[model samples]
Target: MLASLLAGLGLGFSLIVAIGAQNLFVLRQGIRREHVLAVVAVCTLSDLALIALGVSGIGLVLHGVPWLAIVVRVAGALFLIGYGLLAARRALRPAGETLAVTGPATDAASSASSGTLTATRRRAVVGTALALTWLNPHVYLDTVFLLGSVASSQGDGRWWFALGAGVASVVWFAALGYGARLLAPVLATPRAWRVLDAVIAVVMVTLGVVLAVGG
Candidate 1:
């Protein structure tokens, strides 16, 4: 049981450590301070729900439906390409200035930047969450299908492995989104945003190409 738990943890962390669109979006939100809590909550909850669904035996359905993986892969590829293009476009455009804050700090910043922090385009938290959850086929493969299938293969202790995986998801998303605020100042600069946008674009494009090539 202990070995299974540790295995699940290692698997969960390994899959999530990649720099994907979802993580990039969360990092961007943390930098802006806009809807940070919403972003974190949505990400963590979505991950937990998916992990639970996967561990609860739904993963078998994915394996049974052979065409489903192809469809998800195609859809995920397109989404990544689109996101990459958009990020590249944003990188080329004049960067907008806005500050995201919470608690007293936000209120204080709002008062201070009343006229300076103009309204700019931002991704809706729920919309972003859905995109991250559904648009990426790799998510299904990693959490729902692959992880679930592996957990199910663990015989009597399958649930323990699943629980370990689910816990890791909660801990990771929370830490990445909230813990990241500590470096918000560094990420808030226009140069930093530009660099992040570029990196996001590159990562998305690279992933898209790989997926398209049957990865």
Candidate 2:
């Protein structure tokens, strides 16, 4: 059991720790200080649910219906390409002046107005989170196929391994969603936003194209 748990933890971390679309979105939200908690919950819970499904042998269904993977890949690629274009626009056009100038404008009333802004963007953020997590073929490949196959090999210890994987997912998203605030100072500049958005744009577009090509 202990070995299975450790194995799960290591595998889980290895799979999720990479800088992917989901993680990058969470980091951006954290830096923006907008809907961070909600984003974290959605990501972590989605991961746990997928891990559960994988442990319960959903991978067999996935493997049998290979078309499903292709469908997801196509959808994911389209979404990523669209999102990448949006990010590229942001990189080109930026939002406003630096935080140093607008810092004072964020008073109670402004904060309240920002609350409204956050509320409106919440839907978009949640939708993107879901798409990024569920639509990506790699997610199914990793969580359902790879993780499930390995867990099944553990026989009786598979559930323990699943639990460890779930725990790692939770911890990683929590840290990423909240800890990113530490970089808020650095991201206060428009140049910083431009750079971040530009990088995200490239990543999203690249991944989208790769998925489209079935790579």
Best by lDDT: 2
Work out the TM-score per prediction: 0.57, 0.62
Please provide, for model 1 over 138-164, each residue's C-alpha lDDT reduced to its tens digit, 9 standing for 90 to 100.
Answer: 888777865665565455666788777
Which stretches of candidate 1 lie above 4 Å from their native place? 58-123, 183-215
List residue ranges in candidate 2 displaced over 4 A. Answer: 58-111, 114-116, 183-215
Q: What is the lDDT of residue 178 in candidate 2?
A: 86
Score candidate 2 by TM-score against the native.
0.62
Output the lDDT of residue 105, model 2: 27
